[model samples]
Target: MSRLEENILRGLNLIGYNGPLLQKTQLPVAIEGGPKNVEYTQLVNFLTNEIRTLLAIDEEVNAVTSPEDSVAFVMEITSFLKELNCPYTALTDGLVSDRLQNVSDRLLLLDYLITELMGARILQEKKPEKKIELKLQETPEGADMRLILQTLRFPKPPPNISITTLFQKLCPTIPIVLNKAGADIVGEGIFKGFLSEKQWEILGGIQKDLYHEYKIREGNVIDTIGRYHTIFSDRTKGKNELFEKIYHDKRKLLKVEPEIDMADLIAARTDLAIIEKTSNSSVRKNTRSQLQKVIIGQVPDRGGRTSEIAPPSPRNAPMATTVLWWRKRRIYTWGREYGWRSSIQRWL
Candidate 1:
């Protein structure tokens, strides 16, 4: 929801209501070489913290005696695990004896132990008959157990596919994909089975908060700025700046417009140009499918959603040559800009 809201905010910026949303807000006074004051890193970190708070998952193994404890202990642990909704393998007595009793055979279950921190093991009975007990042992460390639990919290792993790809090739970054998945699950009323009432409320509250915040920013508060600020993003869902909407607005920063159309000047149409020109959904998708990664881990100034349809970074592998050069030159002059947050330090 935050990502979506951010996209909306960025989209607004591209459209050129360059004015700060409120009287108190406005672009910073243009600063030529002075540093940009931004708190994006803190903001992303805050959002992550919110997610951690929302999940509030406790994946730790509870304190207890060894696996040799009474039957009640076994039953209790089993019940606890059932409530976790996490995948775990339980070894039967026979399975433990065959796989764990022999030193050579133990290798077969090593992976299970490493991943789950628990596996079948042979244990001597405390009885006078001196029989045997097979059980799962408590791992020497809790790291693996916690890791497994932590991953389940997201429910959706980050996508391996590129965000700009026409087809879903890779997943977007974690917060975006995971939260989005969580939101969808909520929307479908499926999360009710797993998420508690409070959890649902918390998450819903977050979404509402995000939405309200977006409304406030758009309708009330403004992003005042007054200096050249480099923008960067993880580029999830091809987090576009929607250059087309804001092209003319951005032009104001330039002393004069280039002879070429802003879109052409930026060569906004490259590989995706042909299909992008058409309004057909299929062709538009193909145009969106195309994506190029930022070479140096970041890109400058998002023009807007499908704004320029060009890869950022004028220095290397730019989609546009002269157009890109001037585009960047204009940004250089604007002094104020918006971008995906990479760190507290804009460039960092």
Candidate 2:
């Protein structure tokens, strides 16, 4: 078996994949040669399923029989990689080509993808799960009684009383006080017409102060009742503020951008540099040849017909020149030729 095939099988085994047996005889003769359509289709389906299983993806895997199918398959993989948040790698037209000819390239890509996924799986397995600590604090000494008094600010309970005893004495009066207050407020509103405007104005001012006091007392009562059940540290103002700050910090951490994958970044930069160099070299070579052609004059063809120089069409433009255009159009093209698409998509 070829080294690539051996690596693929080893990775599959390591990942606990139990699929159809892949053997040397079943694989293509040459690494660069396309395998039979049937074999290629089966292999793609199997590997795709394996990938889905590893990623716990619920998407259905389709069989590849034609170029369109190949394109769809690649698109599905692109989406899967995206969901995984793997470095984006363009893998569309560049892999299959317009004529749908590069079968070997697609096969090689599948091998690489499986390997990357295997590595990702291993890393994921090795990663320790984060545990969030729930820090709890007990109600401190001398603070409990003080908290109970603060919560019952509305009705001043006698000092030095136990919490249970205070509640026992105060509970019966709570409903009675609330009902009497409600009735008095309602009666005042009904009988306000009988009072002079000056008297009404004075009562309004007193009512506002009473309303404010009532709100404070209401809050205190609720807090005291809550303290009876659970002595949460957040009930204390200082600890509550501290916890808020800590929670805000955690939120900020979550909002912070994820770390960039250096390997993918470097690889993408390298590919861009290579493409830029190739594009520049091609332009220079073309320019020099065109100048030479003009200087030397037109040469006659073997059929006695003179060939005329024509302007290069936009369609014939170098892929590098259209890199920005591709990005703008969001036409992701992948394969060995456009490896830079991986990291570039992240920026998009």
Candidate 3:
């Protein structure tokens, strides 16, 4: 056997093919380097069977009785390979027309295609398995506990037990109690008979204590809400007063029109114009000499002696009189002016 036939047999064994081994005699022999007249009947049949098994193809492999049948088989295999995304391109028309003539050449082509298909199968097998997630269902006991917790958190008012009991107790012969009511009436009667007068009195006392506590909590909550409202109202009032004081100070300093908005005045910084106007008015009032005296009187002599200051100019007589009146008062005049000293002494 040729090396190509040996390799094909080995490949078939590796791929778990436990059939008869392929021999050179089964394949068509080439005569004098010319094309063989015989079709690749045995070779095509074996290939078709192996392809069907490896690819899990459900279609039956047709018998290759003639060249036309072999061509059709090759086309079918090509279609399968394309669908599987197999990259083997050795099974072309040139393989059938030229290489398929010789036994060794046919075996070589088959070896290549078979090796590729085996590789594809191996890769498919080595892929990671898919994982499945399962959700756990709640049991009946868990569901009942959940329901009980929900009922406790948001309990509904009890039904009218007095009316229900009155009917059942006084009118036991009534059809509603005899037929319509089930085990509930019996259970209620058993529960009432089970407790004594002392037990009932104790339960009543507990209920009254709970109600008293609830009322106290409700009152405390109401008082807290009212106190918070009062505090918030006072804070809001204080904030408004502070804003008004700031607006008043800005108005006095800028001397802007009373109707002018505070936002516009501050944004335009029109206070510079008011300062210039005041400076010009002071100049017109001839207060420069009075200003000079105030500065000179505030400054001490370097030789520990009072400087003999010049008298006010006659032209600045009115300004000088106003300045002299200010100089006669002490710096602690604010307490007398506002009467805060007297108020403090009275409080003490």
Candidate 4:
């Protein structure tokens, strides 16, 4: 029997399962590196740990000489493996091999040794767990995993319980695809299952900022959004007129209007002008004070309306008088030299 088949038979016997050997799951045993190097490394680590546990069981099996003591050893191994849910369980068929059937009487030391040897040989030959020394050999011709992961983390949500739960589901199931053929080999589609708007923005920003060899693959919306956010995000929030202009443009596109128009300089001055014009017009001094309060955002009811003089028509308004009072305050002061200054001052 092949080494793999031998191990399967032994594992079945030790687990106290009686079954004909059917077939094993077709997991690729080849260790030649490919795009799945990261996954390969992780699996190798897992398998190495499994082998170590099995070796410990083998030592325990050797210490017992009596058949009854051996059975106890086998039971210990079985319980340990059951907890691990190791691949050995999935490899067995239902046929009860004599080596396996006899395991019920005493621990199957011979079979366990054979199985461990096969596992060790496979592990030794396919040493995927060897720590790889990665260095930036050159400016990469394509995507850098380190940089990509770094940039992609932005624009993603501020992680909380919801994200933690979702990531747990992703890490075990998905094969991480490394960029090789080109940097752009990494596409946004790879992240589609977990990408959010925030993450997209972050990744996109990185792509733009790095401008390193790679571009995110075409047709990947996640990457596209990330790129867009990088290109267009407003990082500044204070007194930015350019941002205000851009904001206004978007509002126009989206048909949104602000609750208050801070940009309406003319309107603000118009209100101020009303208070000024009404102040100079023949009206009760107290009434003008109340009107000024209303113009400045405090409203109050004044008694019956006086026969208020009409405000000058915009066209016929005295040219000099039309100037803002503050601007012409000094020039207007010249008129104060006339008795109107003293008379108006006393009118207060």
Candidate models: Cα lDDT each: 0.36, 0.55, 0.52, 0.42
Off by over 4 Å in 1: 1-55, 58-60, 66-70, 88-348
Name the best candidate (by TM-score). Answer: 3
Indicate the worst ten consecutive residues by lDDT in candidate 1.
28-37
Clashing pairs in 2: 88-342, 90-334
Measured by C-alpha RMSD in angstroms, how accurate is candidate 4?
26.1
lDDT of 2 by residue, 138-248 (tens): 565446545654654546666687878876876676557658568544232223125577976776676666556666776676556445422343335457667566656
Better candidate by TM-score, 2 or 4? 2
lDDT per residue (tens digit) for residues 159-226 in model 3: 56454553354344443443666744433221222447897677667656655666677667655644
Candidate 1 per-residue lDDT, tens place, 1-348, comes to 234333434533433333332122221111110111122112212222332333443422222233343233334333433443425444223332231233222222222222222111111123246459888676734454345436545343344634356123233453465575774442322122356779767766666665555565543322322131124345534433564336446644543212332223222323333344476886666655323344344468756777557666756555467776777556654544554333323532
- Model 2: residues with Cα > 4 Å off, grouped in runs: 29-61, 65-68, 78-90, 93-100, 130-348
> How do these models rank on TM-score, best leading?
3, 2, 4, 1
| TM-score for all models, in order of appearance | 0.12, 0.29, 0.30, 0.18
- Give residue 256's error in model 1 in angstroms: 62
What TM-score does structure 2 among the candidates reach? Answer: 0.29
